[model samples]
Target: MKTLRHITLVVRDYDEALAFYVGKLGFDLVEDSAQPEQDKRWVTIRPPGAGPQATTILLARAATPEQSARVGDQTGGRVAFFLSTDDFDRDHAHFTAAGVTWVRPPVDQPYGRVAVFADLYGNLWDLIGPVPGGACVG
Candidate 1:
């Protein structure tokens, strides 16, 4: 069976994307490489303490005009990314103060307290905290 690995989001500008992911959202930068010879630049970020096996997301933009149009539309369209957090309230407050827009405030659900927010590029994200009896151990 094939397993899912990394996911990359094409952005219009790398620096802006980096600022949103790192400066605002607090994801740690794992790699940043620009290979002109290869006509490609690579960059990735993840939450702190995420191990090597943790999925890494790449911040990239389309290279060609056709690709740019597609990515631009994708950015404005609805897309969701879920992230787990121990302190949902604190993080939600922090992000709110940082000018991040939230579609909904943190709400208590059966699974957890979930709060949704939009990234700089308009991508949606669900910041979740697990409820007490929500553990699954088989």
Candidate 2:
């Protein structure tokens, strides 16, 4: 079986990224190890409750101008991430309370409820929840 395991995000600072993702977004820190061979750290995070069966966010700290330029425009200023939650209202409230910056208000679509928000580094993301009686939809 094949699986897509990780999605990489170019970050400016490791600690800041960790605080945003783990502290604010509530992701779980799965790994944090030193890679002395490359002067880098191996860090990975996943959504809460995902455990070992979810795709991870691999935080790659930019080390060059080219990578730094892509930090917040990974998808050319379009939405670069999608964060789906089981409980729309709860997560929405939590995110709002945490001061997450929303670009659009929540709306109910045929597939689900969605809202656009910008992450700490200004990368756009869709915060989504499943339809009331429907399956998960992106």
Candidate 3:
């Protein structure tokens, strides 16, 4: 079966995105390899404590104006990313202390407890934790 390895996210600076993901969000930096020939680096991160093969996000630095424009809102002003956690309250408290901008308070959905928050560049994301005996999307 085919499996996803990484999803590329356009970022203004690789290091800034790294700090946000690895510092505030507590994701693990999986790969940081220099591509000297191409003048770029391959920077990838995974969810904290998630072993290899979990969905990894590649923080791709924007090399062009068009790419830079997509840095925050990559899905045309919609929340295109969903980050699921096993322990919602712990992460929610952590993110609150970290000063993450939220779109709304957490609410109980049929599938999970979820809240919307913005990335540093205003990209929306859903931080979700699945409810026991419930299903989830993405």
TM-score of every prediction relative to native: 0.83, 0.95, 0.93
In TM-score terms, which candidate is top?
Answer: 2
- Which candidate model has the greater lDDT, 1 or 3? 3
Worst-scoring 10-residue span by lDDT in model 3: 129-138
Which parts of model 2 are misplaced by more than 4 Å? 133-135
Clashes of 2: 0
What digit string (tens of lDDT, one per residue) describes model 3 on residues 32-105?
A: 99999988999999888788779899889999988987888799999878998887778889999998998989
In angstroms, the error of model 1 at 71 is 3.8
Candidates ranked by TM-score = 2, 3, 1
Model 1 ranges with Cα > 4 A deviation: 1-3, 72-79, 131-138
lDDT of each residue in 1-138, candidate 1, tens digit only = 575568988788888888888998888999999979977779888886777778898877778887677653464555467888877767888888888889777777877878788788677888887655563111
Which candidate comes out best when scored by lDDT? 2
Q: Worst ten-residue run, lDDT, model 2?
A: 129-138
Question: What TM-score, to 2 decimals, does candidate 3 have?
Answer: 0.93
Clashes of 1: 0
Candidate 1: Cα lDDT at 112: 86
lDDT of 2 by residue, 33-123 (tens): 9998998898899989986988999999999999999998999989988888888879889989998999999988887899998989999
Better of 1 and 2 by lDDT: 2
